[model samples]
Target: MSHFSGIWIPIITPFDGGAIDHGALHGLVRQYVEAGVSGFVALGTTGEPAALNEQEQGAVLDTILSAAAGLPVVAGVGGNHVESVLERISLLNHKPIAGILVAAPYYVRPAQVGIVDYFKAVADQSRVPVILYDIPARTGVHLELDTLLELAGHERIVAVKDCGGSLDKSLSLILDGRLQVLCGEDLDMFGALCAGAHGAISASAHLMPERFVAMAKALEEGRLSTARQLWHSLVPIVHAAFAEPNPGPIKAALSQCGRIRNELRAPMTAASDDLAARWTLILNKVVGSPAGLEQS
Candidate 1:
């Protein structure tokens, strides 16, 4: 079966003492695995891949792989330099990961053709299946529909993390059905699933993962009402997740749950006090009462 389906957490990298806290990282992985996440996306945007050096990134991936406890894990490999990315993939090729999640080259904003060639090069070199990440907002270029459909034809390019921001294109890909579509945008997950996208690789799942799992299961099981109810409840928390930059708000929420420290690397500050207060309030309402946060 395709390993990319269902609610997968692009886990936040826990920090303590200005380093990647492996202890906190392990605990977080175990928490998600027990919470019933389908798998994990290590070193993805939510994990702050840009903030971590290469050695730190590898260590983080290794830690997550060890703690995943048999759950499938996909590693994120992204950058504007093809050679550098290829070297990274070459190293990752030796790992026991399920797949690699790669994005279009950032900043350079390559053309659609360049985008296609870039992904093709990565897929050609990657030993595992490739899950294309189409987050143009960060990557600075969109993988046009033709580019995506073309990439789908490649045997190694098995799926896509759909964050290109076009409902029409998203629906087209779903209808084409060659590539499995996993929603990358937290807020769009329910709608994408309703439109027949396979599942989600959600950062927001780091908080209340079971709820996300239940919601996805409900949709697939044809329980529309149950899915809607769950989606509505999750909407507020999803808003809070992206309220600041990413990882910051998510780290804050996780900290409140005692899953990780409420810290982030340089240039990425902690969530504002106001945002934290708001998150606490929303978390309580959606997750449970005041006592539940402490207990959870």
Candidate 2:
């Protein structure tokens, strides 16, 4: 479970001239790793894995693995198609991926049993540990707490990315004492940590990994005053990145910080100019100290 905690950034795969910007991707990993993110998530929603082809995904994976220099890389292998997800994981069996993160089926909206079995099948076959992704809004179904508990100790099911939009779920997991809980909601990050969550896996970290890590570490160290100040400062930034859908505000924030050229694939647009400018104000004026990764 320790392998899965802390401020982990669901990295945004940079695009330039209609191609995966490996150079920018490399820079982001380096920056975040230096900034103190415990791990990196490639091809997640922020990375726009849906828009990338298999070859492009493979290439981005290779680039990220190479750039990461040994930080844990959780490949975004989850989707509605279980078979294809399994195939993708099989293809990645040899890669040095820390784990696979798969969301439950969307649109089809399977029963809890089906969702349980779906992840169990993936976990059963995965070469690495698995983090069940419980994003009810995105998946169109919740990773019911009982269902998750049933799957909690299953083979390779070591951790959870619990963004069910509630600290109650996170608290329940910690109380259950079966699985480690990592809060996936930026808005509720401190509350989750306060509720005994181990750490956060937030998209906002992509904008200010240093600040996010700092807030987590402060909370961990019992410095509530400092943590509160930082957390308040962070709310606006988090709000900005999520204003136009994830990775939009984040990518724009990163670009404002000069980390990358803000670009996105088709079907996923970048933030409007107004939002981008607003993100700059939030990042520069509000968040002063960068969140450090090592302490967290």
Candidate 3:
């Protein structure tokens, strides 16, 4: 079975008074596991990994793995330096993780060839499967179709978190049939899944995850009506989740439900009051009284 196939939450790192909230983080993993999410992407972009020091990141991953009980967990490995990323991957290879999510070198904006080489080197060094995170909006470089195709040939480079923002390229990757394509964009998930994407690594799945899982399962089982209904119900929450910058709106919604405190690292503030109020209204309408967000 493909490890990447299903709704996986790129979980947010909850904080309490500026400290790593391991208790809340553990609670989240248990909550999602009960929600039936396929797995998790610990320390992914949504987790505010950049704000976490190495020690904090390691501790966060440890809490997630322990709380996940046996579900697969993919650790996020991101950096502009190849050697540093490789070193991190080397360490993660020892952990009981399912795979590593690596993005293109950010800030430097390396050429496609350099991008190809960087991934190849990382894939070679890693013992676990690598999921290419092609989020160009954050990284400032697109993982072009040809470059993606070339990387698909790597045995260890197994899948892609498709955030490249090109439908044609995304569709092409699906058709190629080499690398499993997992939709990274929350809004495009339904279309991508209908077009044959294996699953999604969704940040918004942090809230009301069971619906997301059900939606994915419905589509996979050829129940279009069921999937469409869930998608329509989910659209408002999805839109609101990203209304502000990520993790903020998401954390706010989670906080209101008492899942975690509505706190974020410096430079990444909590969702605005207007957005949070909108989230409450939408949650009430969509899921009925924020019951889904209540502690498990």
TM-score of each: 0.97, 0.93, 0.98
Worst 10 residues of 2 by lDDT: 287-296
- The digit string of per-residue lDDT tens for model 3 on 1-296 reads 24589999999999999999999999889989999999899999899999999999999999999999899999999999888988999899899999999999999999999999999999999888999999999999999999999999999999999999999999999999889999999999999999999999998888789899999999999999999999999998889989999889999999888888999998999999999899889878876777655843
Q: For residue 113, what is the lDDT in candidate 2?
A: 96
Models ranked on TM-score: 3, 1, 2
lDDT per residue (tens digit) for residues 1-296 in model 2: 44677898888888888877889888878877788888988888878888998999999988889888789999988677788878888998899999888889877899999998999889877899888888889879998888989998796898888888766667789899767788887788888887788787888877656778899899889999999998887788778768888777777666666566778887888889999677656654665422222122
Model 3 ranges with Cα > 4 A deviation: none
Cα lDDT of model 1 by residue, 166-209, tens digit: 99999999999999999988899999999999899988887788
| Candidate with best lDDT | 3
Determine which window of 10 residues in candidate 3 has minimal summed lDDT: 287-296
How does each model score on lDDT? 0.90, 0.81, 0.92
Using TM-score as the measure, name the better of candidate 2 and candidate 3: 3
Winning model by TM-score: 3
Q: How do all the candidates rank in terms of lDDT, highest first?
A: 3, 1, 2
In candidate 2, which residue ranges exceed 4 Å CA deviation? 287-296
